[model samples]
Target chain A: MNLIKLAWRNIIHDPLTLFLNIILLTLGIGLINFILLLNTQLKDKFEKNLADIHMVVGAKGSPLQMILNSMYHIDAPTGNISIQEAKPFLREKHPLIDKSVPLSMGDSHKGYRIIGTDHTILEFYNAEIHAGELWNNLYDVTIGAEVAKALDLKLGSQFKSSHGFTDDVDLEHDHGTLTVVGVLKPTGSVIDQLILVSTESVWAVHDHDHEAHDHEGHEHGDHDHEEHENGHAHNDNEEHDHAHDHEGHDQHEHDHSHDDHEHDHEHDHSDPNHHHYGEIAPRRKVNDLSREHLLSQTEKDITSVLVRFKSKTNFQALNMPRNINENTDLQAASPAYEINRLYDMMGTGTKALQLLALLIAIVSAISIFVSLLNSLKRRKYELSLLRVMGGKPAKLLSLILLEGLILSLLGFFIGMIVSHLCMSAMGDSLYERYNYPFKAWIAHGKEGLLFTGTILLGLTAALLPAIMAYKTDIHSNLSEG
Target chain B: MLSTKNLSHSYKGTQAFNFPDLLCQPSETLLVIGQSGVGKSTLLHILAGILIPTKGEVLINDTSLYKQKTNALDTFRGQNIGMIFQKPHFVQAVSAVENLFLAQTMANKAKDTKRVHTLLDQLNISNRATAKTYQMSQGEQQRLSIARALVNNPKLILADEPTSALDDSNCNEVIQLLKHQAEAVNAALVIVTHDSRLKDIFPNQLELN
Candidate 1:
């Protein structure tokens, strides 16, 4: 009834050509949508990874690599430093330094990267233990959501340490089992793939191995003594000494047995006597393998310390770690700076893709122009007839303009659906690799702008065709025919 | 109701027409006869306010048509004039009633479905009102165009070789239809043609050189 309706009817009259034009326009819009979605998802992942800690302190290497390792857990660490060496800076009670969580990573239990950290890491990272309580002692471990799910581990289940960071090991440790006490809720972070335990647990494993070596040395000495006595026809004292050696070896074998005979003996003896026992009475504690001996055992060290600031402070507190690194032999990195640098390096590719989308949109606009201009020639007689029947030039021009607008809007709608489906397909891989929660229907500010811009471009493309329609010499055209 | 005085026009700097004086009173049919390329269509275009004369003026109801703005002149033409082309040039995608409705919008008036149906009935094209222009026969399309033109109740009706393709019987029927419709609205009817068969249908004739 109106010019716009008439224009739409005319476009639909030739469905094949209109469909082709719609496809072209849809491709242009779809490309733009895909780029926008990718850019948004990547930026969101980066920001989420940077949410907790303000700075990272470690042994010096590439700053970007340090960020990728500590924040995202995707790259190799910058080696470890002695915690004693880091103690002096930690004691400097700066007003800006809110809290610090030391990180020691090297060991893994069943392919999950084990992170030795303090209890403050949970609060600092806003992590909630979904099912069980947090680990309070050595050898008790808490695993992240994906870790639990992948290994089918539950609270109270004990799993042995595998050889490497990945689950492709041919070697497994004997009796080096860790108890899972908690499983963390899914935060869509690097923590979701990590296994967390207290720093004391890391030291206990090494200490336990050292004690086993000492027991083996004692057994060897007893065997040598018994062998020396067996070679001689002995006096009564010598006979008694050989008997003592045999008893001692027997006791050693009994103490080192894997059965619960010793535990049953202890439990029966301690039940009635516990009330009379004093707090200071010497009782065997877990992993109390003498701190002096434990420190002298091996040279495993910490990887980094993630420092959270109290508020929006300056980079002054950041310089403390840098000074320590410069004056001594350690490394410090500002995650914010490294992330910005990384974005700058990757932004060029994003910019290139955006430019390509823009160029394609322009070409699409020109295609629309050509299509409408061509239609003008074919519809000349119809245009002249309208002119004689009191159709104004403005109405004729608006009709063509409306046709272009309809094409662009339809293309935009189809493009959105296409982009959403594409994102949904990539969502699993994206979350796995980068820990990004990419929802299909997430809206970006630039998306609205892009659609509006396409509509405007379409209107602009129609301008020339509208002018041609307006300037149609109805009298000359009619008279000639 | 319509007159042209000392009308002359040129195309590409060559004089194509020179008409001293022409007039058409209300309720009268005037036929313009000429050979091929003798500017009969050009004269009709000028009289319909579609083309401007190089030297002379066209007045409709004592007002100069050339002095009005382009849009205003279009509106005035839509409300006061009707035209039928040699071949019916209906909007190919739309039905006949829709074409008539589009004419109402062009005249900046609200839709008058009653007027459209009445015009279709009078033209005997009521049965084909819902048919698309491409779907209709040539005669049906011609009649639809005539209905579209008269839907706005204009004061002048201009026909440019409207019956050239019709048989003798159909030609007379078309001529009589235009005459009857023009007289019904008290409109001045002007027909431009090279066909000599319509010479006896109109009492007043202008032979173009």
Candidate 2:
């Protein structure tokens, strides 16, 4: 039998102590590996999404909250600003601004926010059309790649937007159904998790409610006058087209493509042939949707604006954010500064966990040392017998050392597997809650260092006991037996 | 053949030991009988190459054992000499047969499972060959220890207090087994013991005073 076999037998013979030592070491090593996996992936995902966008302009509120709500889409928006308020920066040739794409967000479908944005938002993310054409008309929406995949949305799929970013559909805007016109390719950024639509569509859903009430009033007024005269009521309904022109509303009626929509509305009402001109009400509302509704489609507000400057080093670029913040109500937050503050906050907790894991490992190493030393003392006579049976001092030393290596190596492998299992389990819950893609099996560079360190600890722990075994006076020990 | 000349030793602040010259021919059983505190174990250790005596020349098969370097002496002892202690001790982790294998391995010899089994069968502990050494009865443990010592077919076998703790029946059986195994390998067997019961078993004797 080899020394390794002998060592293995000795370890298994006393299962309790070996198990205690291995379990202690496993907890320590597993925790260290857990921290390594989280820290590495967290840094990677944060850096990946923090590309090129330099500043966020929003209604005055928490800068970090605005960045999280706007850039990461995982927090509540600060508030919205008027289109007029953000217009100077949105222009093609503003002095300090290179590009300002406005984002209007309020409604969501299935907890995924539907962002009302121009096509330039696609350029900012460097997204391409994965399938179908871009939205060309109102009520047409484009889905991001991950959104399409996750929600199982396809081209021509229809869904109604909920009033806010929540799963509760109690406040759903069912006035119109949005058809999926396109799906954007995944850019591995926050864009992959959004639904894109035109800003006008945002207004269309909210504006329909007011216009529906106003059209009801107009329908009642004309119907009341016609029905009271009794005979002309039938003729008044036939003269509806003539009446529309005479009211100086012909331009508005001719400008709308609401013929199909009006037909559907008329079918819903029992006596609605006279309300054929209800289509004209909706047409007028679209024309004069008003700066009031446009300012905050529901609240005439956008969550935040992601801004890129003409030059980071430019003097105007430096002063522009302060100028906007002090003179106007908008606040500009740097993504870099906010994200660093975020890391510093999280780093402290992880560092503490890492230290605790290291301490556990050191204690386990001590356990291994004490166990080996204690066993050596108890087995002194046995070792001496081995020497008499033609065993050398080096051979006995090797046996002790091998026992230590087997214990620690087993602990290391089990610890690594446990750490990965924990990550995978936690990753599923995190993804379900936050839509954050966390891969569990990613091996960090420091894991190699951890493995080497553990094995070295095992060997070093055995070193002293092995030396004692080597120096045993075989004759004296054997004769004592 | 095995022989020792002018062997003596002195412990720190302890009385010195002066031992007689001794010789045993091939296939012969020599009994070195002594009382307690007579340094019989010390003499056995010095002869086994385990301890370097203050004055001694131990020659086995015409080669001087003590004339070699410490490591070389260990190697020579492993190949040519086998010693059994008073209470049979083993690497408790391994089986009886595996303990024999470990002996061969330590001696830097190729493993011989067949020889180990054969020796265990001859010693009448073949049934316990696969049992852990610690699980065996004391008599069985001693017999297995004997099998381990004889597995290598050494030139000389030294057994210290081989039957000191045994009853009459067990002591006679153990002495016969040692003599039978030693003669089978054509090696000289020297047993050091304080047990007076062994005086009648062997024809050759060396009495230490």
Candidate 3:
């Protein structure tokens, strides 16, 4: 009976065309919203994590890869640079350098990167301890907030690190198990996705991998002398001595954990007390590795160093990256510059998708217009009858316009819901791969504009048809029948 | 009562029409019979306030129909005059009851479902009250239009070619119902048709050449 009711009824009566119009509009709006979410969230995450690190110095490779690996932790590192090589930037008070934090990355536990770093990294990211304390002893690890929640790691929980940033069991280091000493509060930055430990912990784990053979040789010599004094020939010990003389030395090659090597060597003999120690080899405290002791041998290398400049002056800003990249064997990259380049590359694709979505919306608007015009043409007599029965021109005009508004509003709502669901589905996979905390349900500010734009499109498409309804010559139209 | 004096309308290139003076009191039925091109429908439309005549004015219940502003005139038409077209027209989306309700709403009357029901019952369409107008038998559609026209209890009722497609018996039944409904509301009735068979039926007649 009311104008709106009548308009709604008319739209329902033509279900096939109604479906076409609404579906087109929904696809247009949904695609646009989806593209908006991806662009905004990715930019937010990339920029937020790029905290004042003016340069990254690493082994010579792609500068972008160095930035991504060091600053964002999403790509493979560009090899390692010797501690002695990075020593200048790592100094306590350099004129041009405000601070430099070394990152020793090459390991992970459950797909979360274990980044061996100092306490200053916590300051750089503005992160705070949520529980327990910072890692101070060898094999002690501090976890990110997301890492703790995702892996269900509590203080004192222990896990062995894999050799690279993946959870492949084959690559799990025979290095000693690392104990959780602390959990960090989330800073909405890359720190929330990293596991941090003292840089010496990384060197110590690698040292154990290479030195297990040397310790085996020295221990074998002492045991041989003891056998000679006791006048006893242990066949297993003889076989071990024979195997150690060969070049392969496959037993200790993969059994690189020092404790595991000692356990294996002791297991060949018949000392009950030593056998008990063998059983607890993985739990043995190999805790002597400290930052001072490890850096005393400056040949030990780190993955990269994140340097913040004292001032972003024109001279240093223009010269620092070039000096490091050209003069030294290390690759130096500006995190901000590389990230901006990345955003520009991605922005092109996002703009294209936005344009395509806009085109679809325009086509959808036309569909609405054509369908409404057709409905008006078919229902001219009905309109005239309204005019004859005390309906005004404005009433008829609004009836047609109401049909368009109602149709587009339905399309807008359904489109938004569909886009959100699609985003949530994609967000889970993206988070797993990149560790970016993408909140899929957060509607951005442009969506308010999008809402208004969609309504205007609907109304604009309905305008001409509504005016036609308003200007209908009722007598001529009625008498045509 | 309804009356028209010196009423005429012209198209852009056609000769102008000159209409005779006419009068009909409340509860009285007047039939205007003519051929297809005689502009009988035009005269009815002018009287219904659907057309502005080139000359002269139509007066209904002593109020000149065209004297009010366009919207006010429309509201006045809704409140006081009812016109049925040659073929029944309806907002095809709604049921018979809803269409009658729409008619009363358009006329600026508070929705009177009881009046609609009573009219549908009198027209023998109460059983089809919830059916869409287009889905009904043609006879039922015509009766629905009658219900719509009388829904507001208007002071004047105009029917244009009300029974052109009907048989003699059906035509007689339709005219009688129109006369009865008009008399029940004490409204003036004007019937315009190219159907000459209706010339002898009404007591008052106006013939358009």
Candidate achieving the largest lDDT: 3
lDDT of 1 by residue, B63-138 (tens): 7888898888888888888888888887777788898998888777789999999989998989988888788887
Q: How many collisions per candidate?
A: 0, 6, 0
How should the candidates be ordered by lDDT, best one leading?
Answer: 3, 2, 1
Give the CAPRI class of candidate 3.
Answer: medium
RMSD of each: 10.4, 7.6, 7.0
Per-residue accuracy of model 1 over A1-481 as CA lDDT, tens digit each: 8877898888888788788777777778888898888888787767876866777877778878878777777566777665555554343365777777667665566556777776667766577899886766456789889888877989998876543344445433332467888999988666777888765454334322222223334323344344434432222322332232222322222233221211111111101111110001011123332223222322335577787776646667756656766787777777888889988988998888878878888888888888888888888878877776677888888888998898888878897888888888988766545544577788866887988988998889889998889888998788667
Q: Is candidate 1 or candidate 3 better by DockQ?
A: 3
Best by TM-score, which number?
3
Give candidate 2 regions above 4 Å deviation. A106-111, A135-139, A160-178, A200-299, A432-434
Candidate 3 lDDT, tens digit per residue, A289-408?
Answer: 333443443555688899888886658755888998889888888888899898888789888889999999999999999999998899998888888888889898888889889988
Q: Select the stronger candidate by DockQ from 2 and 3.
A: 3
Query: Relative to the true structure, how large is the alpha-carbon lDDT of every model?
Result: 0.71, 0.75, 0.78
lDDT by residue (tens digit), candidate 2, A96-175 = 77776777776788888888777777777888899997765566788999889889999989988776677777656645
TM-score of chain B of each: 0.96, 0.96, 0.97
User: How much native contact recovery, as a fraction, does model 3 achieve?
Assistant: 0.75
Best-first order by TM-score: 3, 2, 1
In order, the interface RMSDs are 1.2, 1.3, 1.1
